[model samples]
Target: MHKEVTIYDIAEKLSISASTVSRALNANSLVSKKTQQKIIAMATSMGYRSNTFAANLRMQRSNTIGLIVPRLNSYFMSEVISGIESVTNDAGYNLIISQSMENVDKEISNLKTMFNNRVDGLLVSVAAGSNGLTGFDIFRDRKIPVLFFDRAPHGLTVPSVTIDNENAAFLITQHLIEMGAKNIFHITGHQSVSVYKERTSGFKRALLAAGLPFNENQLIVTDLSEKAGIAAAKLIAELKGDGVFAANDSCAATCMNELKLQGFKIPQDVKFAGFNNDLISRNIDPALTTINYPGFEMGKVIAAKLLDHLSHKSDLHSSPLITMKSELVIRASSNYKP
Candidate 1:
């Protein structure tokens, strides 16, 4: 095995004190540029590497931010993470990402690991089953900044960023109603989540505004998976609703496929709309009409806000909630007429 080079080795070669070498390596103001360059050159020649643990101890900062998400496989979540990475990297910060896999226990474990790592800040999109976060108290107690985006905890005082789910769902529902869709069926995920709850509420509100009867049988709550989509389509076919509003595109695509197999003429027999303009939405046989939720933009905004708070030590009380606008995209799936 190759021997590990140390600062003492560099100091011995340069005939300088280890303290001077340490100061020079850390780019401290006390070290002159000439000495710093000489020390760096000698260290490079000796194959020396800076000890991040020691440096972190000295600076009292990790220079790393922690991020926790439900899952990384979803297009929307992946795009959001990419956006966050872009901003954090530009700001000279490293991000440590972990997935909770929609499990409350996994989320708790991830939180503990992040806290132990002493991350400068944390960004989280809470998992599905996470009722409340008792473990996050470590961050609160330590005064580390924590920001939530997307699926955030309910009734928390932490800063959060999300889209206007109610308005977006209402707009999409209205669009379906205007296309001559009567008896609209709403397919959504777990009602425990604020996003799904708000979406369901918006759907009901749209029905009320249109003076249409809202049927409890028309609402289907599932796991928001492709399989759930197929199951939802079967239920929709049995119910024979004229319109279907799926909470997400993945489920919408699966439902559409199943409905097509059942010989239902899309848009003509059952006008359909989905949320989140995912790539799958456009690739489906009849392109899905959806709301552009801007996941990437949401991620970028959340990360930028957290970084700003860290740098400026700004009070988070000013903006408790940051809601982004969503735009509706009209595509073949919801276009009943030519």
Candidate 2:
């Protein structure tokens, strides 16, 4: 039977104390660079495997960050996960990711599991129907850092990283107006979500600022899915709105396709735009006008900021907010020239 190799075996082989091997393995500053290399080489050759669970217990930290998002099915979230994992892996941290599917009950349950696992930090993009977070007090009591991103809850003291949704929506709507669109409609997700709520506000603000007609009926709320997009397109066809701004590219792309099937000439009979600069935005028939949301960058910032708070000292933002920059990309879908 083969015996499990331990750090003690490596230390005895190198004629050094186990403490020195431990320090070298953890990359302690006290260990010389040349000695660390030797130790690592010997450890690797000897088939030494680290017991991370035991090491974490000794350090009183799990080196794990819990991430909760509304859903992971979107391209935006995929980019975010890629960026976050890159930083976390480099920093020797692991991630425990969960999706809430926009369900408040599931979100609360996810929070409980994270807390039980004793994660060192947490990142969240809140679910719909969760306007506020109350189950986070346990994490707060334990001194675990929690950062919100993209879809932060309302009235929470937790620091958040996101783009200016209100302003972005305003810019998109204003661009439609500039394109000679007299009647504009903003198709979005659950009105309760902060991003959607802010976008609706921006849409109204742009309409009011442009001296155009503003009413609640112009704000079409949906699940922001492909089916929702088709339904919204039908509604827009009946309403005869000259401009349509969906909250995401998927909805906007599908809706635009449906509109084209309905015999409407894009940018002529009905100008359209979307958000998130997703791949679909550029591949469609006429291409979609959209806002270039930096999902990957946002993820990096969220992870880095939390890591900064965890390592050496606390470096949290005093304002509890980090607003990322987003830009509008005009395309054939909305760039109408009279």
Candidate 3:
């Protein structure tokens, strides 16, 4: 195995004092830029890498921000993480991400791990049934800055970046109604989740406002997975509706595919709309109508805010609840063109 190169090696190679090499590497203003450049060049030539763990230990900071999400495979979440990486990576900070898989117990375990690691900050999008921030007291007690996005914890005053879910849902439902859908079915996840609840509420509101009957039977709650979408499609086949609104595009796309296999013509037979204008939504045989939730932009905004707070450029206590803008994207799946 190759031995690790150290500052002592660089110092010896350059015939300079170890302290001088250290100051130069640290970019101390006391050391001339010319000397610093020479030390840096020598260090690079020797394949020297700084011991960041040792440095972080001395600073009493990990220089790492922990992130927790419900799931990591989703297109929206992936885009959000990419945005976060773009900013945090450039700032020389690292992200430690984990998924709860929508389980509260797993979320608590992930939180404990992040806390034990002493992450500089935490970003989370709470899992289903994470009810009332019960597991987040430790962060509050320790004064750790926590930012929630997308499916955030309810009844908690935490800094967050997300879209106006209810308003977006209202617009989508109203659009379906405008397209002449009277009996619309809403397929979503747990109502305990704020995003799903807000979306379901908006769907009911649109129906009630239009003097259309808001059938309790039409609200189908599930995990919103692709398998769930297929199952929901099978059920919908038995009890059909004029339209359907899913909480996310993945399920909507799969549901559309399943419906097609079951001989249901989209838009003409059943208009379908979903949240998050994911690539799958656009690529489906009949592109699905959806709300453009701007996942990447939301990520960038959230990461910037968190980084600013960590760097002390912004106050954590004064962190704002940021809401990103979204618009309904009409597509062939939901639009009826004679």
Pick the lDDT winner.
2
TM-score of each: 0.85, 0.84, 0.83
In the range 48-95, model 2's lDDT, one tens digit per residue, is 864432346457688889999999988899999888998999999999
TM-score (C-alpha) between model 3 and the true structure: 0.83
Pick out the ten consecutive residues of candidate 3 with the lowest summed lDDT.
50-59
Ranking by lDDT: 2, 1, 3
Model 3 lDDT tens row, 1-338: 99998778888999999888888777667889889889888887888864332345456567788999989988999999999999999999999999998899999999999988888899999988996377778988878889988877787667877788888999999999888777788999989889999999888888888889876889999999999889888877788787899999999988888989988988898899998899999899899999998888888888888889878899756855777899999998888843
lDDT of each: 0.87, 0.89, 0.86
What would you estimate as the lDDT of candidate 1?
A: 0.87
Residue 197 shift from truth in candidate 1, angstroms: 1.0
Best by TM-score: 1
Q: Candidate 1 on 1-338: residue-level lDDT in tens?
A: 99888888889999999999888888787999999888878887787854432356577688889999888888898889889988999988889999998788899999999988778899998887675566788988888888888877877766888888998999999999999998899999888787898999999999999999987898899988999999998889988888999999999999998999999999899999999999999999899999998989998988888888888756554787888888999999989753
**How many clashes show up per model?**
0, 0, 0
Q: Rank the candidates by TM-score, best first.
A: 1, 2, 3
